[model samples]
Target: MDANEQETDREIVPERLFQSDSNTCASVCGAEQTIRKDFLDMLRERHDIERHTRWYDIKKKFESDPRYRIVDSLYREEYFEDYLHIMKEEKRKERELREQRERERHRERKADRRDRDKDKEKDKDKEKSRKDRGRSRSRDKDRERKSSKEKEKPKEEKGKSEKIKKRETPEEGEHREESDKEERAGSVDSEVARQRENEAEQKQKEREKKLRAEQSIREREKEVQRTLAGHLRDRDKEREHHMREECIGHFTALLTDLVRTPDFTWKEVKRQLRKDHRWELIETLDREDRERKFNEHIDNLMKKKRERFREMLDEISTLQLTSTWKEIRKLIKEDPRYLKYNSDKGEREFRDYIKDKTMTAKTSLRELLQECKFITHKSSDLIKENPNHLKEIQDILKNDKRYLVLDHMEDERNTIVLGFLEELNKRGPPPPPTASESTRRNK
Candidate 1:
């Protein structure tokens, strides 16, 4: 009976230990993992090394419903301490994981808030001109954020680790142990901070890249606008050029038709045009454009006159030498041929003919003097000579093409001949021979 009671007490001890193990796990570890820990404690308590090796089988046997019983004293104080150490270690790991998650969330919130602030700052400067905007402002923003973060760090960091360590009785070797643990935690913190910094730098680079892409697109849009403006300017210039040319053509046609009769002089016709409503048509034109049109109009008038003279071809050929220029002029006017030489251009053509004919006649007269070294001919006397002399002079004048057009301008023919004689007088006969020249010639 005594041996059986001892056996019952031993069985009751295992039952109490099982119950205590469950309570310890619930209170400290906060997990259902207490069974595995209890099994380990069982191997430690047992003196059988072979049973310790077969840990899984022992766990299966003890945890089975048939042998299950609680024993409070089965796990000693040392086993409970080991359990406490294990619980502390597991809780520390869980706390570190939770802290990591909280820190990640904190960094994410800070980054998102900073990005929003950056956008707000960008919006504030949107009203400023783009030309005056400085790219240095981005660096300024980065520096400002760094300064504010540093300014707020002491208060924020102090509150973050606000849980104070209890002042307990000192243990001899605990200082080194605590210092090593703190150092490990600091190293982990520094590594996480370095990763956050690297991520921030990557985000900043991405923002700068997006800004550059947007700026390039804006520049291309401006270039396209400038090209369109240039095309518009060219189109306006071309339209103005065509309108100017059309104005000149209309003015010239009007003048050509006006000068087909001798009833009007060009000066009178031009002066009267202002009152004739014809001048009002061109009044809108600029001064230079109107002047260009007038010049073209005179040229058209002269061409018309020249064409009319050519139509009377028979009379021009017949009266070459026989008619005095005065009668030739009258005959040309009344001969039913439309001859009008009353324009400013007609007088201009007359003067030009006179100048060219004089030049040629002078050249020939000078050569004639060279040929007849001591001739007694006087230019004035020759011009007033008889028909025979006039005929002889006419034969000489025919050789040069410059004087040929004078016949076509029959009214100016006498004036041209007189001008030719004046050019000959400008030479003043010939130079009197010098003393050395006379002596050389006599010798």
Candidate 2:
């Protein structure tokens, strides 16, 4: 049993130790390879833990083997890497959004600050104005008080009661005296009121009389103003009538020109026509007519005048009036002053008579020329046989005092030539015109 057996045991133990070392190294290599393979799978798979995990099994596995720590650690590392990157991007976006919101809030605050400052400035100005108004109002009140005080005066007379008041008197005595004074004051006040009533009655009567006088004066003034206004209006109407007469004269001249030359402006013709014939006082007054029959009478007179004048112009055109002029001259030669004079006047009257006839002939001749163009051409033939008649016709055209008659010849019924003759017959023979017929014709 001894040394050889101990050496054999030692050799066997060395062999066993070598074999165990080899086996342990092989197991460690296999475990490391398995762990590496699992790490690669975890990386590739990127496992989800939040939704798919069963809590009980996971707890059991952790409690049973604690090797779940390795898988969990691996999973957490991958999970944290991707999740942390996403969280960082979300944080950056949130920061940008918050910055934008902050910028908007800052602008709103600035605008609100400006508005508040403006309102505050306005309020400050208003407060300053109100304070100034208060000071000015106080000054005005003081001035009014001073003016009132200055206007009050002290009385000069002192009564018996005032004299008595300066002496010391008993209270009962003072009361009895005061009652007596009050009774006396009441009696005096009644007397004063009676006097005032009498005075007021007299004053009222005077005032009433004065008011009646003033009313009468005002009525007289109103009557005068109304009469004056009527007179002034009548004067204005007379002036307008004169102006219309002048314008009508111009219109008649233009019409005569237009008849001579047809190329005249109708616009001017219409304007002159409207100015001359568009208005009449009767038509204007017709609106306010209180007497219909009077208005009708005036209207009838005007209508007759217009109708007669128009009819006569039509007759002159139709009758070829030049033949009558020839007959009138022959009759005038037979009896020189038969229709012209009474011989009571001198040659001056005879000249006036010839001038009047010549004027009538000129106006009648113009009407003949305008209305009877064919007759005027035929009348020219009479000049060859009757040289005297031609001389008279030339006198009527050039040196006759006919322009004056032309003024009134516009209305045959209202011709001034006939009106003057009627008026002259009513008066007697008048003096002839001093100027020559040529000067009268020029006028």
lDDT values for all models? 0.60, 0.54
* Model 1 TM-score (2 dp): 0.36
- 370 in model 2: Cα distance from truth in Å? 42
**Residue 353 lDDT (model 2):** 38
Native-referenced Cα lDDT, model 1: 0.60
Cα-based TM-score, every candidate: 0.36, 0.20
Clashing pairs in 2: none
Off by over 4 Å in 2: 1-191, 261-443
Q: Any runs in candidate 1 off by more than 4 Å, and if so which?
A: 1-172, 253-284, 306-314, 317-324, 327-333, 336-443
Cα lDDT tens digits, model 2, 1-443, are: 89999999999999999999999999988986676455444433434333323333234333343334555554544543454455467678999999999999999999999999999999999999999999999999999998777665222223444565666477855796789889999999999999999999999999999999999999999999999999999999998786556445444443443333222344444444345432232233322331333344446544554344334334342222223434333434444333332333323333443455556666664554344222243344454467565446444544433433343344652343334334434554333576556677888
lDDT of 2: 0.54
Displacement of the residue 140 alpha carbon in candidate 2, Å: 61
Best TM-score goes to which candidate? 1
Q: Count the backbone clashes (under 3 Å) in each candidate.
A: 12, 0
